[model samples]
Target: MTGPAYAVLAGSLRARIVSGELAPGQRLPNEQELSVEFGVGRSTVREALRALASQDLIQTTRGVSGGSFVSVPTVRHLSAHLETGVALMAAAERVTVGQLMALRHLLEVPAAGEAAKHRTDEQLEDLRRAEFDPAVAVGEATYAANQDFHLVLLRATGNPLLEVITAPLFRVLATRFGRDHAPDGFWSCVADDHAELHDLVAARDADGAVTAMRRHLDHLTGAYQQMDRLSRAR
Candidate 1:
């Protein structure tokens, strides 16, 4: 019964917020004003604001100059939003691990090629460090270093949108998967591959970068299968 009216009101306001009409830190009209503006009751306006608040699109302040203001979500915030949703969807069997891997390949392969040409010298140095900056511990440091390598490559493409959409995949795999349990030599092999990838990027060898990235993904197939088994066990 409340869906059509209040949901519509929330959608209308959400549109304005997303379209830059509302803007970050901009205070929305008071409840009474919003109700009048949307031709709805105060309760409807309240419900709409509640919806936006739940989605992290707005925040309400309680002081003298307080009201709801547009929330400026960080990249982490946006990626976190996808994390729970995608995690739940996977749990519900609506998505498969293979499907996620495929999508990541679609995104990351091209990104590797792009990064080879676009990456700054500073980013290239970071890649070099990320490949080699692990301690003589278990695979934990190596696992972290692996994550850093992919993050740098995606960021090197200078595409914020790419990083936002794909980071959760790596996070979900690392957290719920058996990456920490990767065998002792596994980390060293990963480090070696990363070093090769670094050289490719430094050489501006786009073709070689793509080939190296694809082979690296191929090397991960067994690890991906291990994660799939772990997910089912949970």
Candidate 2:
């Protein structure tokens, strides 16, 4: 009739961790102590801790000096779960290339405008370092650089939530496209798009950034749709 004892304990602990009641790397009370505090058995305490650990909120150590400790949630840590979920959805065919393309346009069009407004000099330097050289052909290196530039652009929005959501979507596309060679000049065209976007971003022209981002997504949508067609024909 009621929530399980372990879930109640886990929920309480999760709330504490998120509320700063339990600081990152702070060791939790021992199982016996937790059991007494929550008025549950040792097994219930363990189950609760295990639940939090699975979510990467609490970590357990196996030595006498070790117990459950609050985990520091980094961007990478949070994005890892999203990446896994996206991959599964793609594999299950719950998501289509068309859908991914549409989602990207929705998220990234605003992201470009935001990046132009909020991006720092250091982030701009990172974009330059990514090097949108037109001479580079499509391959692993070009793919990697393109992915980096887009991820950096998302991060440049100064919006962690946007970065977390779209970075993994970028990754899902990269993984899908990485499986094959592209037509000649494919990467060069990609580089050209990045170059145009970079200049707009560096100019801090929010309107131009939005326009450029939309155009780039339009190109990418066509490319992905072509790939989908090719896959279906074979």
Candidate 3:
């Protein structure tokens, strides 16, 4: 009943969407109806809808039967949004490099184990296709391959949540500090680790995959931390 009218309306709508009170693809009330119900102007309702749309909570359409509807978020959409948030937090120093590495260890090691246990033939083939020799692959091609390898490994776990939650952290770290500041031979080491992990997963050695992933993270975390330090010194 106080504060900015549009912001208050947006917050209420956001809570409903988050709590599933407003189901995905559910159409919202028309502008006039919302305005009357909330005791706000039509412009305020429009602004609130715009705000929700910006957050990917709702989408709008223009046709005879179209209006604003709650959004059904895909894995890629969720991951990209989270990646933006992570990048912003890192930029603000609200989250440190240490915390990110710790989270990756918590999420990815287990994900590798799961991949070993649950990976399908098609997922395994995809993982194999993601491989690249850092020696032979150059620049963005090598970087893209490394990204694909990790992404495919996560996908192999057969858990969309793992891919959604963990992919952004690696992507942010890689873009911000992981690539340019790496010491010599770092990517070569990464390629080797990926190969070892793939073999373990392909053999369905869950524990071995976990151990290999742990070791691989140990190698990567050091490089990430070193890069963080260098970035600060500049």
Off by over 4 Å in 1: 1-6, 39-44, 62-65, 132-135, 230-234
Minimum summed lDDT over a 10-residue window in model 1 is located at: 132-141
Better of 1 and 3 by TM-score: 3
Better of 1 and 2 by lDDT: 2
The C-alpha local distance difference test score for the whole of candidate 2 amounts to: 0.86
- In model 3, which residue pairs have backbone atoms overlapping below 3 Å? none
Instruction: Note the Cα lDDT for every prediction shown.
Output: 0.83, 0.86, 0.91
TM-scores of all candidate predictions against the true structure: 0.85, 0.85, 0.94
Which segments of candidate 2 are over 4 A away from where they belong?
A: 1-8, 15-26, 38-40, 61-66, 177-184, 232-234
lDDT of 2 at 97: 83
Query: Per-residue CA lDDT of candidate 3, range 1-234, in tens?
Result: 457999999998898899999999999989999998999999999999999999899999999999999999899999999999999998888998889989999999999999999999898888888888877898888878888988998988888999899999998888887467788888889989989988999999999999999999999999888988887788
Number of backbone collisions per candidate = 0, 0, 0
Of the candidates shown, which would achieve the greatest TM-score relative to the real structure?
Answer: 3
Order of candidates by TM-score, top first? 3, 2, 1
What is the C-alpha local distance difference test score of candidate 3? 0.91
Off by over 4 Å in 3: none
Q: Write the per-residue lDDT of candidate 1 for residues 167-194, one digit (tens) a residue.
A: 8887776765566555445666777789
